[model samples]
Target: MSESDSPDDIGTSPDSLDLSPREPSARQRRQRRPWLAMIVLLLVVAAGGVVLTKFLTSAIDYYCNVDEIGAKEGCEAGRRLRIQGIVDVGSVTDNATATEFSMSFGGVSLPVVYEGEPGGIFKECIPVVVHGILRDGVFNGDRIEVKHSNEYEAENPDRIVGETDKGSECSQ
Candidate 1:
């Protein structure tokens, strides 16, 4: 066939075709719109999830140093809370039924009461985190998580030295 005989061969050649100027059809545009909408929806959902997670975590987590708990208002009575402090000297009172202790962080001291058997590391001067609620004027603790400071004893090289054994010498 002659080079200019057919209209279908206007932008095409036998060896190479130049079909770069074609406009997209209506069906192609419609198909792309849904995909774009889906991407926007996914981004919105992810952002909402992040905000919800932050709100939930903040509502559940609570931390208060011993002094902060005492000086602040509305701290003496509340829901479950966490208090961090060092055990006061001669403040641990253990009996057959329960263990009562007091801790000092900064200038404040708060009493902690635990009903279960105290751990081996439960002693005066050790750092601890008490978990419970404050009812009336006292902290009614259900669980205590003791965290002893790192200490090394030269006399006892075989045994690990912990703050619980040191006995109430920690400074506020």
Candidate 2:
């Protein structure tokens, strides 16, 4: 209650007053501004690398025809494939464990063994795409995509076998 002590100076002390602004720590710097952008960019690059690896490893599958099995570059054994061929008449045999069949194209037959039943218009004398890997001489297939009547006629309307076309390397 002294007269020299004003209301403003009553509660203030020199030891307690610190008005200088201090630099932020390294942790604080990482949580704001350019560091944030760098962090985001790093994450984006990591994700892109993962996607590219997945695409190169499995997504880029090889497609070929029945006659191109051993001759094609990507149609070798121990790799994934999409082989297209016509289902030979009376070659489909569905036992309890699998469906075994032979597909013919370029007058060559490729034996396929699928582990499951195919759906959506699959039958004899039709073109199909078999997805799987070739082990030895047999194709260990997992899926069958029948190029049904409508799709076949629409896509290959003029695919005629004539004297000029490669006459059956398979046929003697």
Candidate 3:
């Protein structure tokens, strides 16, 4: 048969073809369900956020100061807490199993017994955050996080560490 008589050769020109828009297939409709996809994504994200908040809250320990300890209930019942205070000078005693010291804030003092290794920053008058439980008028600290302020030299070379001297060369 001639090439023109073949079915494959039918309507080869652009004008002879049916070019109108066609309805989408089932597969295409399912793939393009934006509302369903968005709802699923939102549910997953909300569940993840709720789980993260619960985990973080359970892991955190609340912090308070020495002066607040007297007014805080459940302190002496061995409840785990984070207490911030300054180490009292000449109050540290190093022992075999533990290091005992007194930390004071606002004239309120509390004894602390730490059995863990105190870091190099542990010194008299240094601020620290102790994580442990309070019992029998003493805080049994299992962990210590030292809080050190930033060290910056003022413009004046002869003045105190952070003090500014008007006549010093730093003003220039």
Candidate 4:
């Protein structure tokens, strides 16, 4: 044992002693930050997926003509849809509880059982749009829109109908 060596410095040499405070390197800083960043990124992605699914579901618009629906297999049971057709004359039967009718298009007929009142202009041979679902081969309708053609005009000089307040025009 050397006389100059003390018991307090038994195994450590002067070259091996590190007494300064350590500063973290760039790699260590990066490692500590990723866990928080990853959690935040995952939450953002999940929220985006939910919003996208909701938008797509609400934006869906499914509609078809009576003939097309009858001829194709795309209309699944219990799926809501819109059907465009001409109301058959004498086919409407309005009861105390419901209105049952038949519509025709391209020789295809669709039986509709509506639980609501038909529109004011609804009648034989009128173009209509029915909103409903097909159950047991019949349309269970909730709403009906009657489409009227513009046949009455304001400019016919020969007007053969009842007189209006014309204010001037009935003669050429």
Best by TM-score: 3
Compose the digit string of candidate 3's lDDT tens values, residues 61-158. 45678787756763434567788888886788998889899888777888999995698689777788888888888999999888887866457667
State the displacement of the C-alpha of residue 160, model 3, in Å, after optimal TM-score superposition: 12
The per-model lDDT (C-alpha) reads 0.73, 0.79, 0.77, 0.77
Superposed model 3: Cα runs more than 4 Å off: 1-61, 73-77, 150-172
Residue range 1-172, candidate 4, lDDT tens digits: 4456677766676733445656889998888998899999999999999988977864354457888884556545567888878888678899998999898887788999999789769877778889889999899999998877777657888866554432222121
TM-score, prediction 2: 0.52
Q: TM-score of each candidate? A: 0.52, 0.52, 0.54, 0.50
Native-vs-model 4 lDDT? 0.77
Which clashing pairs does model 2 show?
A: none
Worst ten in a row by lDDT for model 2: 163-172
The predicted structure with the larger TM-score, 2 or 3, is 3
Arrange candidates by lDDT, highest first: which order?
2, 4, 3, 1
Q: Which wins on lDDT, candidate 2 or candidate 4?
A: 2
Q: Which parts of model 4 are misplaced by more than 4 Å?
A: 1-62, 70-77, 153-172
Off by over 4 Å in 2: 1-62, 149-172
TM-score-superior candidate, 1 or 4: 1
